[model samples]
Target: MAKVDAPAVEERQKGILGWIEKTGNKLPDPVIIFAYLIGILIVVSVITDWMGVSVEHPVRVNEDGSPVVEPARMLFRSELIEHLLVRMPTIFTSFHPLGYVLVVMLGAGVAERAGLFGTAMRAAVRNAPRFLLTPAVALVAMLANLAADAAYVVLIPLAGVIYAAAGRHPIAGITAAFAGVSGGFSANLFPGQLDALLFGITEAAVGSLVTDWVMNIAGNWYFIAVMTIFYLPVIWFVTDGIIEKRLGKWTGGAVAGSSDADDDPDAPLTAGQKKGLAHAGLAVLAVVFLWLFLTVDLVELVSFGAVSVWGGNPPLLNPDPALEVTQQLIPFFTSLVAGFLILFLAAGVAYGMAAGTIKTHRDTVEMMAGGMKDMGYYLVLAFAAAYFVEMFNLSNLGIISAVNGANAIQQSGLPLPIVLGLIVLFAGVLNLFVGSASAKWAFMAPILVPMLMLLGISPEMATAAYRVGDSATNIITPLMVYFPLVLVFARRWVPDFGIGSLTAAMLPYSIWLLITGIIMTIAWVYLGLPLGPGAEVGYTLPGAN
Candidate 1:
């Protein structure tokens, strides 16, 4: 294969990218797209329901002992209409990421509004050496997945600010941060809620075939650690070498200045500001210690009383000697979003008090409210997205498509590696529509997991492959919940930046990450490397002939 110069490739692709930008920008806003999707889903559901399109349930059994299959249900009918109209409020409220985002923002808003977040981020970036700035931001963004959405909310914008402050193209910083946060999403050094969620489905899939099989949530721990290391340079090279060069220089007006220091980028940190930072640091440590005391088993004897007061031992992560440290702290891992809430809350309060940003208790409360206020558009978008997703599920279109896709692959006489690559590619295509990784996996696992196991691939490998595809396409997809939000962040710096511009900027990351992920997946499979702590690249379904 001929090596393509980044600049030449970018130049050659300009026409196509410009077309995408023109077309995408001309389309309605994300919320409108979702609302339109809801309508389309209703129409399609009626058509499919009338046409009697359906698929046999992959894992479920019927009461009469036959396979339980799902058929398309019309969303326009009386029952479905009643659910949509009457329970509309509940539909929005029960959206999975809604609560997480709201809870986290209650704290993040305080920090951001109180000026704690900006000061801290600026200080951190200002102190970093020139050469390490790009990689440092990328690495931090990769690890920021532990904070879930906060990474996108905080790090991506800060990256642009940092890069602009350092005299580079601010968009490059945004791209790098986004690449790590979204593109390398699953490639973390540690497992968190994502591990638990996907592996739970993996467990159910395994149980369908191997009755006695057990799942360790840390199944992809080692693989992701290696993936993180492998991806670091990819982001580094792309950001510093390719992206920055292509963008030329930072002539996009003044960088976003400090929110609190009279809009000055180089304003000296006041004595009060320094003190606030120190107090914020201490607050972070205190919150960490508090969570550790409550969650870690070693302190159960002394802290059990306090832990019980807060509703006591979590269901997933109790002191089970048989579990890995990560598995044992499943409760902690899952509660990270809330943990971040308290973390930012306390730190923000401490910093605000010392920095005089919070002159009164009412000020702190107002800041928290301000955070939610910032999320107003997000709430509206989520409501539409939630209904669309729920309706799609109700229509059974997602599953039917997934099953048919899997069946097609199973019947093809393709090589195993090639089949897996196609699966990854298919997932990338599907991700353009379904942004929720877990939701897509929930529908696909029953088919892909079992199908791959029969083909000598492990559920861990299947999940891993799914993750690679899911993450690689995230940056480019408009339907992704945070995609518009990230664009909002970008527009703050460059007022003219549109969804198309954001999509075009992110396309490079998506392509390179997808290529790297495919190579990594194939290499890992060919070498037969362990996918996780106790998981292998191959599986033997119990009693399979």
Candidate 2:
């Protein structure tokens, strides 16, 4: 290694990043690109239709056993592409990224940026026993996805602080959180916009292949719940045994300088504040009790039969209980509002007692306003992202590519395991270019879901497989919208660290999980366990396949 002064090293690093930044800045975001991609897909569909390359299924098998729904020709000619493109605007815009992030996240922003998230996280870390850091972080990371950006933006930085406070390298904490947030992206009990969006595409895809194909939002909920448990130990071992000690203090990536806040010694909570918290706790329990009492299921209270957990037809997006059921405190996006309300009350009482600033509604409103103050930049980003996603999906080019490619995979007659592996790999590869899970899945589900069903795979299982690959590679993809923000965090801790270094550091996680998830999937299929309520591993039925 060349021994250069820090100044020269800094300048050289800047030059490299400056170049990369310039190139990246010129690149359209995934939303815009997806729009263009959707357009291309539309063009192909038109071409294929004009060329008469599509297959038509009669009520009976016409000539070949090759089902019209699963025909290989979907990808072959250009017209199928046009059909894909034309239909994209409706689908993509509905799941538009701007709308995608904002609807659920407004309350998230309120809860987090208002200092509730930060204070709570710091408190948890500060109070956590040493043995609990790894699992705690892993759990928080997965749950943080509930707030989407809050998890990445707030939790990642806090991880560094938490790790450093524990006498470990801050980077390790950051990495663990990053792994949880990005790597565990698909594993959540509650449905978010992403879950709803992906389910729609998978449903469309599966329906195209089967006469009775359906997909629900809780498709992977049970398996992911298991994964949360499975991964907690893995993260705990890796962090405590490998990451912490290897993460020596104040190294290249550990936080230095004045910016590090976790270094501050914890101030004692006031006796009054503690008392206030007792009040808040009782209030929260009361609210929860009332909520539970109101929502007692018909199956429990009467003989009206089971309540529709999925909320009805189109089970994945609908709250219809007919399809699937999994645990969640509130309905997907709406829960954010409910959560923030509780947090606001809880935190407000604590703050009031400690600071002696509040006794009325005015004070509470001010606290909320403070939260809103922190949200300016994100709202702009959200609006821009929304427009970008909407436009890109209109393009349809990406859709054609996914549809065509998936068609090829279906006809290959590869063993189920092999096909799953290939899909995982394919997902990883595509991730290099695309970062939005729903957008990519929107492109893929219509093609892959149906094909998998033809081969006796369930839509739920296929969605889970796709989730694994999509999530595993998130850490490695520079194209991810938040990738730059993460680099900024890394550089805070390791000022000398470059973008490449951060990516390289994260690669171990991405690679390891990719392999682990594949093995898990094979095992899951072998067990023939329902992926979730109404979700199965094997073929639909003897006659169906």
Deviation in angstroms for 517 in model 1? 3.4
* Residue range 1-545, candidate 1, lDDT tens digits: 12222222243224655554345446666667667767777788889899999987665667787877788788777877788788889877766556666777788788778877656655655556668987787777877675565677777877777677778788888889899999898989976557755765565555434556555556788888988998889898988888888878887654563473433435667899899999999998999888776764444557755545335554445667787764566565556667767988999999999999999999999988888887787677666666766676666776666567657666887767777787788888777766777657755676677678767788889999999999998988766778767776676676666666777778888888889888888888888998875678887655445
Error of 1 at 438 (Å): 11
Candidate lDDT values, in order: 0.74, 0.59
Q: Predict model 1's lDDT versus the native.
A: 0.74
Instruction: Judging by lDDT against the true structure, name the best candidate.
Output: 1
Can you give the TM-score per candidate against the true fold? 0.68, 0.69
CA deviation > 4 Å runs, candidate 2 = 1-27, 58-103, 106-109, 189-193, 204-215, 240-255, 259-265, 268-411, 538-545
Tell me the alpha-carbon RMSD of every candidate: 7.7, 7.6
lDDT of 2 at 453: 63
Choose the strongest candidate by TM-score.
Answer: 2
C-alpha positional error of residue 522 in candidate 1 after TM-score superposition, expressed in Å? 4.7
